[model samples]
Target: MAEAAPERVYTEQEVEAYLGENLPHWKLERGWIRRTYRTHSWKSTLMVVNTVGHLAEAAWHHPDITASYAWVEVRLATHSAKGITDKDFALARKIEDVVCWQPGREGGPLEGTPAGDPRFAYIKYDKT
Candidate 1:
């Protein structure tokens, strides 16, 4: 029997739908699924850093990470391809599952907030 190929590349619209239905922790932003984690302190932050590093290594898909005393921001983007891919979303979902969130999860200072960026909106698609 022939092996089935993995669906790796997806249009931005498709990715938006996928993220909306399957991954609530992810948000479509700047062509990437952005998620942030808050830690108790610097030590906890380091722990998450190492854990994230290992996860990224295992997936063989790296993410842009910003860490500080109380938080770590994880951004997924396929820069080389200039858009999001299955690898990026897969890794984002995995990271979300691993990280524990509190009541106010998104309050932590975002490292690089893209203010008023138009690229994050759902891209128009042609169904016909």
Candidate 2:
């Protein structure tokens, strides 16, 4: 069996540029790419954590996650590579897409959770 090639680690400048152009909400800090998601309640926070867990497991790339009563913070880096790499960015993009999805704005049949309603509120999506 052939071994996988080494992943290319991204420099800080490259990470910054990618974050600016592709993921405006994410930032590079302490040698890792990180993003924090705000939620309406603890339930929502757990949902975010579980969602991220599922995505990470499916992608076969994991991220360090921290959660509290109303927020979740995700930090991504390539542990084996000892730096941020393409895998981190790819997983981050997937996490952002799924975590921040709002079906109501997509003109699709699925109307998302009711806006301005605490009972149905989940993620506190960043305004674009």
Candidate 3:
């Protein structure tokens, strides 16, 4: 038999503590945890949406995605449980990894992102 998926609903404290350490930009609110990724242009927004689309589809767990001119917000919660669950946390990490991806890394193809272009660089994180 296939292993069952984790159904444990994370307490508010657990959600805050884990997202605080791992996904600093994500915030808990309205019984959900979410983050909005700012992009440089409409094209960048499209790229972010497409990336999230594929990831969510592959994981078989989707979040409410809102894409606008230069930003995309992803919200996650286990609707069945009326709260967050381990699956939400797992997928959130995967989304973060790809959403903040840098070029030349093993990730979603940068076909739309211009080659070696500095303007495409969104908020740069220290290379620490």
Q: What is the lDDT of every predicted structure here?
A: 0.70, 0.96, 0.82
Judging by lDDT against the true structure, name the best candidate.
2
Return the candidate ranking by lDDT, descending.
Answer: 2, 3, 1
- Which regions of candidate 2 are displaced past 4 Å? none
lDDT winner between candidates 1 and 2: 2
Candidate 3 weakest lDDT stretch, 10 residues: 119-128
What are the RMSD figures for all models against the true structure?
Answer: 12.4, 0.7, 4.3
Q: In candidate 3, how many Å is residue 43 off? A: 0.9
lDDT of 2 at 83: 95
lDDT of 3 by residue, 46-124 (tens): 8888898899999998899998887888999988878999878888999988777666554666544455686865533
Sum up the clashes in candidate 3.
0
For model 1, what is the C-alpha lDDT against the true structure? 0.70
Across 88-114, the per-residue lDDT of candidate 2 in tens digits comes to 999999999999999999999999999
Alpha-carbon RMSD, candidate 3: 4.3
TM-score (C-alpha, index-matched) for candidate 2: 0.98
List TM-score per model, in order: 0.65, 0.98, 0.79
Best by TM-score: 2
Q: What TM-score does prediction 3 earn?
A: 0.79
